[model samples]
Target: MPPRTSLPRRAAKSPALRKIAVVLALVLAYQLWLVVQAQGKVGPGVGAQRDARGRFAVDVELGFAPERFHILRLQKHGRIAGTDGHVVHLRGVAPAGVDALAREYWIRHIEVPRRGS
Candidate 1:
């Protein structure tokens, strides 16, 4: 019998294992890209303008028309004040809730509501 060899040496010698490893790596990279893309959709100063109760008022712009499911998801973080076209107005959202809402794929952008709008 031969002496024990390292795991990297064995994997390197097998083309099948190398292919599996490459595929797995690519899959991981794609998942990471999705997370980054979601995070980037959040606008600057989102969680900055909070009310006295430490709740935020924001307008979430969606990639598509607002639906019941979308409203429900937003309601998880705050109350849905109204919806206009692709934008949904949310109030009473906490700072941590803003981060969680930003991770939704359908949410294109989340920003503080404009004045006098």
Candidate 2:
């Protein structure tokens, strides 16, 4: 004889759930569209420059290409580190109080780290 087994039960599907799912999907799609549009071009809200001490201060859009300045990493708390072993900060502009993220940035005279994410 074979041993008996029972499968776990799942909640019954509801029309409300389906509607919610559809709405969420649509909202997500819209957000993705915005991101794609932003990626196509850097907005006026975007910019990057070195300070008097050769440190960096930036207020670039999320999709801003880091390849132009070779920015290695945008650290937490507005600190951005470059490939030159020096840390910089973004001045005059931030993501409107939102935390800044380290994305693709380009610059010159810098060394990129070879390991780790």
Best by TM-score: 1
Candidate 2 matches the true fold with a TM-score of: 0.34
lDDT at 99 for candidate 2? 24
TM-score of each: 0.71, 0.34
10 residues in a row with least lDDT, candidate 1: 33-42
lDDT of 2 by residue, 1-117 (tens): 987554322212566667887999999997676555444333332333434554334533333345434343444334443322242334433443122232232221112222231
Model 1, 2-117: lDDT tens per residue?
A: 99989999889999998999999999998787779876777888878667898878999998899888899999999998988999999899988887887776788988888854
Candidate 1 backbone clash number: 0
Which candidate achieves the best lDDT against the true structure? 1
lDDT per model vs. reference: 0.86, 0.39
Which residue window of length 10 is worst by lDDT in model 2? 105-114
